[model samples]
Target: MKLHPVLVLDRTYTPVSIFSHKKAFILDLLNKCEVLQYYKSIKLSSPTMDYPAPLVIRIPVLLRHWQSPTPTRRAVFIRDNFTCAYCGKIVKDNNATIDHVLPKSRGGTWSWTNLVTCCNECNQKKGNRLPEEAGMPLLYKPKRPSSFQIALNRWRNKINREFLEALSLYGIIVDKKKLPEGSR
Candidate 1:
């Protein structure tokens, strides 16, 4: 009795609702919307019906807009590859936690630049102290997460032929070319 999940997006490209996968697919075929992914199906039924209906989960297509990624604990962990910023070790199995480079009490706000993924041990030891105060240095400088990058990350694992084709229409694709020196 697995159920499919769906993500609904508003006209402005913001996530607004989630629906059954079957409903999403139907909408896509009817030209009412676009499909983001085809997730596992779930059995659904009406109270008055004897049999269950199968549904698949999906995300709605959105209009293109230049927007920045929202800052969140999950986003930070993904952006850092679940690795501790100070120790450079990957955190897994529920051992990862979000840390602030500058303690919030010391005037740090919840933003991507000030937040990072850290192991429980590091977070506990670095409590309320700046990295420098704890003799720790960040392996990478943090910056606001990019919306395009976040979108790619979210869909990378689930991408398929149709998804790739659709994304390509928006100029999104994987490139292996090396940048010329001094380009940055």
Candidate 2:
């Protein structure tokens, strides 16, 4: 599937609204919206109800902004690159789990600053124990993922060349050079 260029908010990476190819063309000319990534074309039924047309789409300009680093298991794992915070071992997405720097029982609250991604083994070994107690320490402090980072993860499967270029203009650098060989 081909990607359609979409516009996302400058720092927030939130979808404001969607634009048709015709609309995107005008916005690109007017500089009101910057493109992020292109999504696959979708067929929409014609207003006359007899036919469908494939059209390019883009993110809209009026999206809501919110805080970053929403603390959730998936978000933590993605933020930590699916690697165990203590050992640096990469884990599969499904095998990743959230670990607390400070155990909940010891007054820890579920927040981005206190959570890290871990493998099952590390989680089991460190269960309910403070990092110091478990003889483990995080390689880096945990924090919320940026809006751009979260949005990139969400749209990775649908991104295309034009979208990548557009996002670059907004300073959302995607490290194409570091992608694993053979990875899409």
Candidate 3:
């Protein structure tokens, strides 16, 4: 059977990676990590006690090699807050597209700095041309997102209020309004 994976954060509460339910439990049992949240509907049962399945856990040590996520279409949408970079219009996932600020013909590679979330209309309007040539200015400059930012965006749906509160305590503000309605 496929088990739901648990999110793992580092000692500083920066999201690091995902672990299997069994691994999470083993870490918790070994006192190597602490459970921050538990799955609401699942539990681990033993002869002597029952424990809620871990949904999120934090390790006691810092991560040495956290990697940033690749700039995929979904990640780009998340980074741009699902808003058209050219027109600043909020868009649903189906209506959003990735636009290369500098057209491929002009030597722009498919990198984070070149990609931006764009609406269908804006995309078509800027097709195969530089933003300047298309008379469209980007609303914000694109940059590579940190691993923590990517993790937060990628796993927002799986995270609960307590995790969000912890993020707030660390001064990380997730703009709920900017996220897609379906994502919450």
Candidate 4:
């Protein structure tokens, strides 16, 4: 099936979610969102299909970026998929601690860019030494994550199936795509 997808952007034009063409058209018709781009062709054959096919739409308002959550131990755990950056262990319980990629004593501050989820053994072994100094390499670099980033991951991994079914109930068909990845 030809799944015509539409990208939904915030009023600022930052992509926050994606919807099917039907949903996009509804948003346009309801004047709830503004069309930013149109698909190259008009494929809708219904008598009600008077509007252009939208490739991108912008919500009339923006969600709060100011109150987006700051990085915390739990947030870091969720961001990292609860996997250790050094040993790739899927840590459960309260056994995880946030480790500084660059040790704080030498320079690193407790920021997302500098911190990662690490287990007790690895944390103890690494100590205050840098990864290179201790001959331990990071599995992946850390990053500062936003609410959008976290939401996308949650949707992709857990909520997507339900979202698709729910959209189907509403007669919308969102084209599923791999979420854009970032360092974390």
The candidate scoring highest on lDDT is 3
Put down candidate 3 lDDT per residue, 74-118, tens digits, no spaces: 889887767899999989988998888988888988999999999
Per-residue alpha-carbon lDDT of candidate 1 for residues 1-184, written as tens digits (9 for 90 to 100): 4324344555644544335556665676577775444433333455775332322223344534525667888888877767799899979949999998989899998998899999999999888999999988899998875665654454344434443443444454644222123211
- Cα deviation in Å at residue 53, candidate 1? 22
For candidate 2, what is the lDDT? Answer: 0.63
Name the lDDT value of residue 117 in candidate 3.
93
lDDT of 4: 0.70
Clashing pairs for predicted structure model 3, backbone only: none
Is 1 or 2 the stronger prediction by TM-score?
A: 2
Model 3 clash tally? 0
TM-score of 4: 0.56
TM-scores of the models, in the order given: 0.56, 0.63, 0.68, 0.56
lDDT of 3 at 84: 92
- Candidate 4: count of backbone clashes, pairs at least 3 residues apart or interchain: 0
